[model samples]
Target: MCRLSGTKSKKEMIRVVRTPEGEVVIDDTGRKAGRGVYLCRRLSCLEKAYKEHRLERSLKTDVAAEIYEKLRHALL
Candidate 1:
């Protein structure tokens, strides 16, 4: 069996955001023209992302409560 080291084997958690105009996508390239938030694919990252509003800041817009809920559901 092949075992990977720490962080390398971990799944990279990225944020997929849907715009008000309805665009669902991953913002890895950081050039998407809509709101975006990032997570480390970990529960902690998701929580922190919400608490700190990292996603909102990244996307440069105010996020809606429904969007937050959706993100939480998707992350979990």
Candidate 2:
């Protein structure tokens, strides 16, 4: 599900995770360890999550802008 928009389909969302080492990354295989957050495949959703600090709240850590840039590059 998309944590930002509340979209409830796994196939339509991408998983972003914060590793135990405190690195935030895109979880392509969905098997990474650590806290995870979901966002819709759209760039808007990613932006919304970034702008609102939703991912930070969900992962309980500070999210860097580079992470969102990486997501934009990967998703778009």
Clashing pairs in 1: 13-41
Show the lowest summed lDDT stretch of 10 residues, model 2. 1-10
Looking at model 2, residue 73 earns an lDDT score of 91
TM-score of each: 0.53, 0.82
| Model 2 stretches with alpha carbons more than 4 Å out | 1-8
Q: Tens digit of lDDT per residue, candidate 2, span 1-76?
A: 3544543666567898999999999898888999887778888888788778899899999888888888899886
Off by over 4 Å in 1: 1-11, 18-37
